[model samples]
Target chain A: MDKTVNQKAWFLVLPVFLVVAFSAVLPLMTVVNYSMQDTFGNNQFFWNGVGWFKELLDPSTDLGGRFLASLGRNLFFSLVILAIEVPLGIVVALSMPRQGWTVAACLVILALPLLIPWNVVGTIWQIFGRPDIGLLGYVLNHIGIDYNYVSNEIDAWVTVIVMDVWHWTSLVALLCYAGLKSIPEAYYQAAQIDGASRWAVFKAIQLPKMNRVLLIAVLLRFMDSFMIYTEPFVVTGGGPGNSTTFVSIELVKIALGQFDLGKAAALSLVYNLIILIVCWIFYTVMTNASAERKPQEGAA
Target chain B: MARIDLVDLAHSYGGNDAPQDSFALKPVTMTWRQGGAYALLGPSGCGKTTLLNVISGIITPSRGKILFDGEDITPLSTQKRNIAQVFQFPVIYDTMTVGQNLAFPLKNRGVPKAEIDKRVAEIGRLLDLEPYLNRKATRLTADAKQKISLGRGLVRSDVAAVLFDEPLTVIDPELKWQLRSKLKALHRELDLTMIYVTHDQTEALTFADTVVVMHDGRVVQSGTPAELFDKPAHTFVGYFIGSPGMNIIPAEVRGREAKVGDHVIALNRSYDKLPDGAKIEIGVRPEFVEVVAPAPGLLSAKIERVDDLGRIRFARARLGDAKLAARAPAGFTSPDGTAGLKFDPSHVHVYADSLLVEGAA
Candidate 1:
């Protein structure tokens, strides 16, 4: 049978196409346009070709150095967050009551931090870490530990890291919790019958079962932490001489604060490229972890 | 291997002060002999799995003790009990190789490395899992995972008893048969005390030397397959054991005679006297009901429907208020709407209330 090709059928997707164009494609196209040009005040523009990109890529230049520093800061923060949160999340999720009214209450409480607006979370913690009036700050100072988030770079980094953890650790915990819940009761019972110890049970059953969800948690946390702006911006304002300025904060400061659209546009594109490349790497590793498995190898 | 004895065992998921009727497993005393293959057969919520859990020490019974060869072990955990159980769904360590999965139990007990490897290899070979020994458990098919689960149970020689709770439930139909036969063969070869729990009668009958039929959280009957078939002690057992089950019809019994709608039926054994308010019933299997030409001695039946099941034709007949199924042998003539049927005297059992009456066949 010969199949008839219908040209008019493409009209059915016109609405979705228009919606995507307006919502996504248009703004990205504007960014792409800005990325390729030099902008002056009063809407004046000059074609720069890849001049901005070249400047953004060079560590010798101030702009390139700042971008690299911000990139390193973002990567380091993400690593620290992951190192602290992943195991902590698993422990919390494991200790969580498997059933009963307590489960609902715990979930609602755990989800509370995630529900807070990012800027509001920052504001809340900014006051929370105040040396004079804040409970945490006052307590830390009274304990004879020098605590100040405003002037000290180390203090500022710690406060920002702690704030991000408080705000987002719930996400990791919840993902791990969902993963833990999905394991069947039979696994636990079988492990018991097999004389598996608590650690053995965790290693053999719980940990492997939580693998997929943990991957999801890591990816989500990595991406979100990489592009994080509002929370740290509101709380720390990239304080202590740019010690906590992640790439997104740097991009915002360059574009709007200094009105250097050309450099900012270049930085933004590079930042986006970094995110895409990192996410692709994560996606590749996770998918390969499953794909590299030999199909029915040694199976009868 | 140990002879597991449940001494007045009872369990209730509901907390203390719960009534007797609320107990998931009612107080019952039973023993599973050493090296015997027994099946706990019942419908869902009939306490089959509950009983299996109790035996494996997964659930501590609220009342009474569990004994293994005369040693009371009620306070012991499943690990302490040295019991191994294969669950309804295969439970395998997904990250481990099949060999590691099988060797887990032995390793946990601090068995020597050489011994663990030897046992793992032995079980792997027995279960036809030798080829998959090095494979990751997650990479195998559903049945292979189940085989690994079964292999884990068998790897430990010191296991007091290996319990199976509907272990074949997750396997595909074709694989279920093969795995079930393998389990039977393993039972014969190892002579381990294996107590299987299932709702399937065929699974119970084929895999076990003794089948314990349960209903409403109580053991209705425990006997060999042939005994349960020929003589179901309880009305529930009669209704539950066979394919179409036993035909139980309300009857009035007085001495050696039984009356159904004023039609007299001969009793093979004598009933000395009747108890007041006894709910008498005559139970007979469909296979034992003989269809004969319309005769004076036979009970008249109206053949409502004949279900042709290839070789044997099953005739569902209306005998007064009762629905009786009678199976015709191969190459037998199909009876018309009106046919006379005789309840095989030797196979017929008289029930008083729901319990089989003493000295009544």
Candidate 2:
């Protein structure tokens, strides 16, 4: 048997390649150029020969040490957000009604928070967590607890985490609800015939079936939490010390706050590399886990 | 094995209604014997599925008593009813192996591991799925997945009944015949009370020993296939069960005969009382209608169209304002112009106000 191959299909993708090269590749090349060179004012540049990268790798320097610390903090925050949000979102989704006008009402309400601007979300939470006047901080302080997000690093971290949950938990819930709704009613009927308890039904049927969507939710939450900046920066401003200074905040302070352009460029490159590596690990683990299972056709 | 009895069952989606919007399924009383294969045959939106859901306890009836082996189970949950149902589409878990999918219910019930394995093997063998046991269920073809669904239902022997809700609708035409026969064989082997629901007459007639014909939220007729074919108690039953359906031509009842247009056909049986001004209809199956040359016969017809279905020939002819279908053998020939149609008096049925008149031929 002979096979026919089409080579002209590459023409259709040429425009997309050009667009990506102009938008993404060009800017990335500029960043790489800046990272490798030391610049004084008036555009005079000299090759630093990996000098900034070396210093950033050394733990004694402020840049290297602070970068490592913030990286650890970002990882911790992403893990905590995933741990709390995924299951809570699933629970909320499962409790939603299957049909009716109430389902539409619930969906609209859940989507409202996601539609708000990210910067506005940061500002709103900033005022909402104030110790003296804010509703949450006032209640906690009234109950004989000291809650000051500005001065305390732990409080800042907690406030940022809570704000994240409030802002992004609805996304996970909506995805889960869509997954649950896509499930055929026959599964429920089969479960009932099997005399499965509510928990058993959820474990065997609901959870396993929502695996694909749950992977999506986890990856989205992980990436978003890792790149988190607006809300935490607005609330903490990198904190009273180095405690709540995540990678993004530290990168911003180096690049713009201190105007150390060459080092900032090197730090930004390292930051991007970290995110890329972590995201690649997450994608690899998830895909490997999925591939280990039997290859079921038509799952998508 | 247990008999299921539905007493005074009625279901309404909302509260008490007006005359037109009262109930989806009117109050019904029926009993299904153990080890019997039954079918609920009806058109779309005829409430056959609603009645089946009520029996399965998926939907609680507004007013009814459901008895399984003399035990009240009306208020019981579906899980408590112990009834297995195969739905319109295949619903097997995509992530599990064929063996694991079949073994799920048994595992949920905490059956011994060995017993569960044995039962899964048995069901897999019955379904011709033994070779694919290790394969994920969703990887199989549509028909194969449906067989897995069927096997999942048939895996458990302790269930009270197995219900099929148009389970073969998604199956290919050639596979439907094979699966239907397999189900019949399974019913005979297991002696489980199986209730199959479908709007297809061929499936109902071939699979069920007792076919329950439903129309407009009511059970029009419930009897053996032969009984339903030979003697349909209602006009709807006569119209629904046969291929080409039954020819229901409006007629007027005179002493011992029915008048169709200007021709009067003699009846073989007598009715005690034919109600005054009651609209009557004469029903005759296509098989019983004989076509002959236009002679001085009981009725005259013009041959309109002839349909040859390989083995049988169907001649649709016009008799005055009414059209009648006549079935003949494959080699039977008829002229295209005018043809005379005659009906055997004994095969004719007289219906008044949709109900079959007693002792009417």
For residues A183-206, write the lDDT of model 1, one tens digit per residue: 989888999899999999999989
The digit string of per-residue lDDT tens for model 2 on B19-134 reads 53468888789999999999999999898999989888888888879999999999899877878888888888766899988998888888899998899999999889999999
Prediction-by-prediction clash tally = 0, 1
lDDT of 2: 0.85
TM-scores computed on chain B for all candidates: 0.95, 0.93
Q: Compose the digit string of candidate 2's lDDT tens values, residues A1-300.
A: 887788898999999999999999998898898888887767888888798999899889887888888889989999999989999999989999988999999999999889998889988888887888888888888898899888888898888888899899999999999999888887898788777789978887899878878988998998888888887888788786877888899989988887777888898898888779878987898887677554444421
Instruction: Pick the TM-score winner.
Output: 1
Q: What is the TM-score of each candidate against the true structure?
A: 0.95, 0.92
Runs of candidate 2 with Cα error greater than 4 angstroms are: A1-22, A277-300, B16-21, B328-336
Q: DockQ values for all predictions?
A: 0.60, 0.48
Give the winner by lDDT: 1
